[model samples]
Target: MPDATASILLLGATGQVGHELRCTLAPLGAVHTPGRAAVDLRVPDAIRRAVDEIGPDLIVNAAAYTDVDGAEDAPRRAAAINAEAPRVLAEAAQTTGAWLVHYSTDYVFDGTKRAPYTEDDAPNPINVYSRTKRDGEAAIQAVGGRHVILRTSWMYSRRRSNFVRTMLRLADDTDRLTVVDDQLGVPTWAGWLAEATTTICNSLLGAEGASKAGCYHLAGTGQTSWYGFARAVFAQFGRTDVAVEPVSSDAYDTAAPRPAYTVLDSSRARAAFDLPATTWTAQLDRFCERIGTEKGTPKAPFASV
Candidate 1:
């Protein structure tokens, strides 16, 4: 499957998933991660120039404005980075003969469906952030090039400022917590996504790479509500001191209305690339184990909250 030594341009190298990707994508090719000064995603001209200058065979875009509630206040900035930037990259990829690998969110769906959302489902973004991400997906598809759009849900890392970290911090500071129980989604480990992405990049260099270009639901297998996830996090981390109480989402007055359900069906991706599937709980357990070893937290079996 060695077509040629690929020159890869990886965007958003500092982000959670991006950081994991930086490690996993290293073996595939020469990865060049440009800083904001080198390539400003806010400016389309800067993005185009970066693509033109690097002339990469593969571009993995992990940069995104992920502040869901803050997006309501700064829609323009979100649109610039999440919406227009992808369109420019897709066009540049088409011109440079590079395969663009982009990450989107399962929030594109309204979350009303009881089952996992498939690639064919129409996007019904209910918030500004999700709208911008959904728009980005549409723009990339419209550009019509060798690209793969992977949509994941509830992605978290041991190092990032995510739910797992938040829960740990809360347990350290307080003994009681109120978490939303209505909303449902699958929590995906960042390392798993990075591994999947590397596999996809290798496939891209293979003969079947072009055929796999399109939208695919790439995410965790099992699903759980935010409340359940919080419980599991505290349980696995041996934070028995914290008493997490489940509450309705209506208890909080958030700017964005989170979808009630957003589980993603990653069956297509697994079948297409021969990827293995793992449950969110298993991923979380692995993550907790790492946290215990690295962060000096106590690790235990899955305990009920």
Candidate 2:
């Protein structure tokens, strides 16, 4: 468990996982989440200055250039935030002897594997986003510091403009949706990721758990295609009027080539952290329940972003 007096510096506090981390890490220690204006990830000097100024015991980095399709056109920006920034942070953590917790994605793998990916699986990124994230993971490992890099997939949150929110927003007017069914992965909830991260961090802080520090596949249990995920979201919202059609990847024309199968095998994370696996459907139900309770109706659409 983390010491009560541990000072944690959290980057990307306003992002989906980062926002939830602020709440989950609160009871563990004091969490200082500086806005981008103070610790701009694009600038390496800014990152070094922030780490030096905060002098934190732990640094949880959740920020990244997450635009999968957009990265194809702007690879430099993605590399700056996802690759170089993490390298800088890892170096700083090495210097400070602080435990660094970083988030990665299943995109690191090319969807060629028949089964889910484990920590031992070699990464074969297919796009700019995945390549950059893979580079970040490598940089962190090369630093050889006390760090945990978690690779998750298809993350959605109530606040962010993610798959679930986008589906809800599109269902407002569209009656029929054509979703790709070829790509496969788990739809992880950001809140669940945050909570699991806290548990893992506590374990890492324990005496014997330091040896477990390494890259682990941390994601929601179960797997589904984009079409299946969209259907579940529509079902949760009781939007029977919106028809969801399953289509092959060939039908889509995205700038980036997403992996056809990237469902992460999180057995290592479960064994390491003693974390339970929750199915994606269960999480979706809970998210919908929260939305209903908060808005007093299940049909309350998120204001269009």
**Leading candidate by TM-score:** 2
Query: Model 1 off-target regions past 4 Å?
Result: 1-4, 292-305
Model 1, range 1-305, lDDT digits (tens) per residue? 35337899999998888988888888877889998889899999999999999999999999999999999999999999999999999999999999999999999999889988999889999999999999999999999999999999898886557888788777778999999999999998898888888888899878878898999998878899999999988777667788999999999999999999999999999999988898898787676665444323654222221
Residue pairs whose backbone atoms clash in candidate 1: none
In terms of lDDT, the poorest run of 10 residues in model 2 is: 290-299
For model 2, the local distance difference test gives 0.89
lDDT accuracy of residue 252 in candidate 2: 80
